[model samples]
Target: ELFQVGQEVEVVVLDFNENEERISLGYKQLTPDPWLSVPQKYQPGTKVTGKVVSLTDFGAFIELEKGVEGLIHISDLTWSKKMVHPKKVLSVGQEVTVQVLEVNVENHRISLGLKQATPHPLELFAQKYNVGSRLKGRVTNLTDFGAFVLVDKDIEGLIHISDISWEKIKHPSEKLKVGQEVEVVLLNIDLEKQKVSLGLKQLEGDIWEDFFHRQKVGDVLKVKIARLVDFGIFVEIMPGIEGVVFNSELDENKIENPAEVFKVGEERLAKIIKMNPANRKISLSFRQAQADLQKKEFQKYLETQSDRLTLGDLLREQFKNLSSKDNSKKEGHHD
Candidate 1:
């Protein structure tokens, strides 16, 4: 109001600066500091609804009252989703229900959590899925190390590349692709970190057991050479079942070069020399198979000679040969 008109107003003296000849007026200081009662009103673990007034990289500032604001850190935004920024989950003027995690009276700050206001999804997932549980899921994403499977809505489980298949694979893309439907076994669930580990190969029956049931040591099988290395040759005895034949076991004779002796796609008879069920590996030997075949043939030849020869016929032939020699000696003496 202009003083020339002599306007009437109420004012309280805040400070009187005698040196500067100035008077600082105060109208808002008439009320007490609201922060003194803030800790009592908004205690820890208290759920309150507030409007988001501003957002920062670390958290969002929510206006709980006219002068009181609480910060919701990015880590408290969700239980499972990893957010890079607060804006990705919250916006200005958004009304959100948050749980007060701490009330620092000394610093006059209120820490809040957005996820603590509701039941944690990870706890619910643990209740629904237990270890060894079989569930169907879709491949939501693929990485160099593993694939993220959407086991439930908004819930993803990781299937590491090593657990994708029994056979060795370079990447998860070799066995799975995005959007592919696959059955998985729940390997583990971490409630503290809210992490789920899944396995795709565990859903399928163990193939090694089936292979071992149909094969044993000394059993000869026809295998095709799949790969050749300096130390050994890998032969596929059956689909997904490969056996390694070391260079020393590749041939009966000394082999200068395994590649020259064993070519890819070339079929050869090999005997199972060793098998490791724990490691799921098989060792084969072509030289042992050749030796077994030769021994069997020699045994068959001996049996044939035994069937033709008789003890009495052998003795009569020997006596006749002895008499002819004696008669020839007597004739020579008479001459």
Candidate 2:
């Protein structure tokens, strides 16, 4: 179609060898070089329509015009996905609108972007939503560490295992399944990495926050022993919240082995000795809880007998008991 038979075509003379009667001739050189005017014609950011001519692992070749083709790197094919192949998105002879990204006339190369022709999906997603925004999405895939969810047509957000639920989970599959629809909170948008972080647990609210709101230090509550280790006993103060009862806090008298005395699933009263919401940790003491109960009982007993003994008499009685204990220890030492 480009050239006709017997058509007189002007050609550029290249070389002549009279001895062998051979003369090298050029026809393309006689015509204007398309690349010579490419620098001015195809400036960066220029919008143009082209036909997909070829596909490769690296990118797709788009024929902008006769003798002028540009390369659309696989990355520029889409704004949301990173590993898309050109054949999957485009086919030979398919017309596509593209934006000129770069033009190197010397190398006869022009970089084109299929995605740059339209608005960036991440930019549009950011406009419609923000960090902390809640939306419903379908789980596309699950990995050991997290789940990928299709939040938007082109945007897939990640729900890390830690963000899957308030309860500890070994894998994301425990809480989420592929193709399951779920509500998620937008935790973060990393524009630089073109990634969106989402959280399912955030929609439920922080369990630790609710626990700290209703509870405080020195408060006593019955907790079930979840695990009994050599050094301490892990007890669940509330559902999905565990605190440790150290060996030292197990009893007023030292406990050498907790397993012998404390069994898993057994319930015991524990006093909240310390609460650290920053690290989501609570330290409970079984010994202190018992002591607090004893103090309350003694106060109640004193109230009932207040008329019999005044405050001064009660103080003297307590002092006399201490003095007798010290004297007994001294007498025993002498013996």
Candidate 3:
């Protein structure tokens, strides 16, 4: 083809060696550089069609023209679906319409997105649902921290372990299992992060309010120890109502080891020394309850003596007793 007779064609002179009388010819240099006009023709957000020229571990390259090409990273392939390989959603030589996310003319690169071609699923879900909306969902997956429940056909929301029950649980699996049907309240919806926070305990009215309404500070009640920690002992004063008795408040006697002093299921009279309904926490003290009982008995004894003597007679009796004590002490000192 290089030595065809009488062929009229375009040739770009690469180098002209005048001293050697030789000319280096280039065929590709005859065509204009397509990248020079890429920025002006394909700005960010511009819609373009291209062929999937090649695939790589990170992304797929789309050929926009003979000399122009763009990259569609794996992350920009879909909003929710997790794709391991580009071949899962795309193939070589497949024509695809993409949104131009960015165009770097200086580097001769174009960044394209496939998911941007359609409406975002998160934005659609937000428009349909709001905070406090109750919806039924199936637990699809479970993790150490939370459970993922499929609320909509394609969307899933997270139920944190803390929001699973009124009583403390070690993990979400304790109350929820995969494929279990449950009702949840939408606590929050974050469109930017594409997160939906759901709660199962919110559906059950706040039990703290009911428990606080029936109990008050200074009330003494028999409670069973539920758990023992280094700082204190957790006791259940009533069903689902737990109170903490610090190590210092465990008893009037100094206790070095609370675990030995208070065993699980052991019952003791605890006085509600501090009750905070706002924080849903109750502070109990066994020492305070014992002291209060003793004070009550002493008051009863004083009341009985008040009825047996007049004020003037009581004062005279007290003065006579003090004089006898003083005389005895003086006699001992003189001896």
TM-score of each: 0.67, 0.73, 0.69
Find the candidate with the highest lDDT and give its number: 2
Winner of 2 and 3 under TM-score: 2
How many backbone overlaps does candidate 3 show? 0
- TM-score of model 1 relative to the true fold? 0.67
Q: Name the regions of candidate 3 deviating beyond 4 angstroms.
A: 1-31, 43-66, 84-97, 102-108, 229-231, 238-240, 252-257, 288-335
Order by TM-score, highest first: 2, 3, 1
Taking the tens digit of each residue's C-alpha lDDT, what string does model 3 give over 1-335? 35578888888999999999999998877888898889888999989999999999888999999889999999988775666678888999899999999999989899999989877887788889889999999999999999999998568899998889887788898898999999999999887888899999989877899878888898999999999998989998866679999989988888998877778999998899998988888999988988888899999988878866777688899999999999999999999
Better of 1 and 3 by TM-score: 3
Cα lDDT tens digits for candidate 2, 166-186: 777889988889999999999
Of the two candidates 1 and 2, the one with more favorable TM-score, higher being better, is 2
Give each prediction's root-mean-square deviation over alpha carbons: 8.1, 11.8, 12.6
Return the TM-score for candidate 3, rounded to 2 decimals. 0.69
Rank order (by lDDT, best first): 2, 3, 1
lDDT of 1 at 212: 89
